[model samples]
Target: MAYVVFVGGLVVVLAGLTWFASWAKRRGRGSGVAGALAAYEEAYRTTAHQSHHELRQQADRKSESGSPDDL
Candidate 1:
């Protein structure tokens, strides 16, 4: 009885996945490199923006502490 239930559950899960794949295909969600490139570009932009912001903040602190000529 337990084996039967397990097999039945697996069948249901697989059927659900099959249906989802079919739906995605119908919606033209085919897998391609564009999605990966977009993700990579977004990550690169975020990292660059964060580094620029930190550098600006550090420079501000240094200026506030007096210019290099004052040292």
Candidate 2:
């Protein structure tokens, strides 16, 4: 009984995924599996890891530079 319940839930989840894929195709982002994966990667990159350490270090160095500004 438990196995049957799990299989039923899996089927429902798969069906929903298929429906979404079909919709995505209509929107032109689901042409190929590779293309869909690429789009997802691009979207992820826009909000993913960023390297700001170099800029921070430059700012810190500018502030710490010895000049007339230093006592």
lDDT of 1 by residue, 12-63 (tens): 9999999988898898674554456546655777775566566657967854
Per-candidate TM-scores read 0.43, 0.41
lDDT of each: 0.73, 0.67
lDDT by residue (tens digit), candidate 2, 1-71: 99999999999999999999889878877447754555675568643222233443575685546878677
Model 2 clashing-pair count: 0
- Whole-structure CA lDDT of model 2: 0.67
Model 2 residue 43 CA deviation (Å) reads 18
Question: Whole-model lDDT, candidate 1?
Answer: 0.73
What CA RMSD would you report for each candidate? 15.5, 14.8
Query: Pairing residues by index, what is the TM-score of model 1?
Result: 0.43
